[model samples]
Target: MNPDIYKLLIIDDHPIVAEGIAAIASRQKNITCKSITCLKDLLSVIASEQFDMCITDLEFPDTNGFQFIHILQDKLPSCKILIYTMHEEPWVIARLSELNISGAVSKHTDTSELSTAITSIRMGNKYFSEVFATLNKRKSTTEGHKIPELSKREKEVLSYLAEGLSTSQIAALLCLSSNTIQTYRKRLMEKLNAKNVAELVSKGKEIF
Candidate 1:
């Protein structure tokens, strides 16, 4: 591969994960990673900059799931869009295809797989994890499978809860009334069939 020919963008909200990807890619002789979190900022930068490929998370603090790919493909039709997410649902795979994503990778996977995904997308090939490929499409057997259908807000609340936020604190951060936050908590528990906070935390880790 030509060292000067490839540039990559990583769009994930987690600072640590983004930095980790940069660190790994920096060690490679022919690849580099630029990290950013916001979609608008990404689009603005991309307009002025050229990237060979993009690896983005399916979720973000400011956007719907994986919708950034649509905007990115519009702006840079030649750039490869790889979806790096913890979501292992078969429907997600179908959805990525519909959006013309270049690849999909699971966060729980090894770093080598990610590096391969980058190279594959850069080479105009699609990548999919073996585990994700083997998962049953008709009935998800993954943990937290029972809680598959989460509202966007519910998914955000669950992530924060796993981060150790109290319901009141989460309510304040989300700008919702305490009662509304409580309602979200209740609904999350019911949907996931969680027995308690501890179980909810455990389950959250499995899915994300």
Candidate 2:
């Protein structure tokens, strides 16, 4: 066991996913992964061990996700929390932010993104997916880059984008066609001087 290794605990209801994630994470430099599939198992193991970070999903069989968070915070306050679940609604993101969870990534994202998230959080920087980052913007500006003002419709689309919605998803929610949403996205990117959708989000957060 390397003394400099980072111990990362993976808490999820599905044992297979937890184990898979642990295996992938173990390949990172000096990081060891541990999986806990149930709350019952966690209670016993937590008392005897300490971790540098914890990645948890908000769903579990024995207890609510919120309860699990409370327990994790109470029992291991020093451990940074990384959210790895599909629940990325505005309310859910906001609640996790209030709880001081350090980072989040969509389940739909690639396995490679998991390594990025871990690295970001390990460096004391918050990690969030494009949409999550848009919604969870912390600093007021990105190097004093002045954000161009947007129209009401554009703002509406931006709001939905911040909530982590896809173009089709936003179109459905707004009762507009996907083409119209695409138009809005293009207009937004051009107006904001963003080269691509990813940069659109990266820059939009400065204003959002």
Best by TM-score: 1
List candidate 2 stretches off by more than 4 Å.
Answer: 1-3, 137-208
- What number of backbone clashes does candidate 2 have, counting pairs of residues 3 or more apart or in separate chains? 0
Give the lowest summed-lDDT range of ten residues in model 2: 138-147
> What is the TM-score of each predicted model, taking all chains together?
0.64, 0.62
True lDDT of residue 201, candidate 2: 77
Q: lDDT of each prediction vs. the true structure?
A: 0.74, 0.77
State residue 208's C-alpha deviation in candidate 2, in Å. Answer: 30
lDDT of 1 by residue, 92-187 (tens): 554554467777789999998988877676667888777566653433455433335677898889988888999899999999988888777766
Runs in model 1 deviating more than 4 A are 1-3, 135-208
RMSD of each: 9.5, 12.0
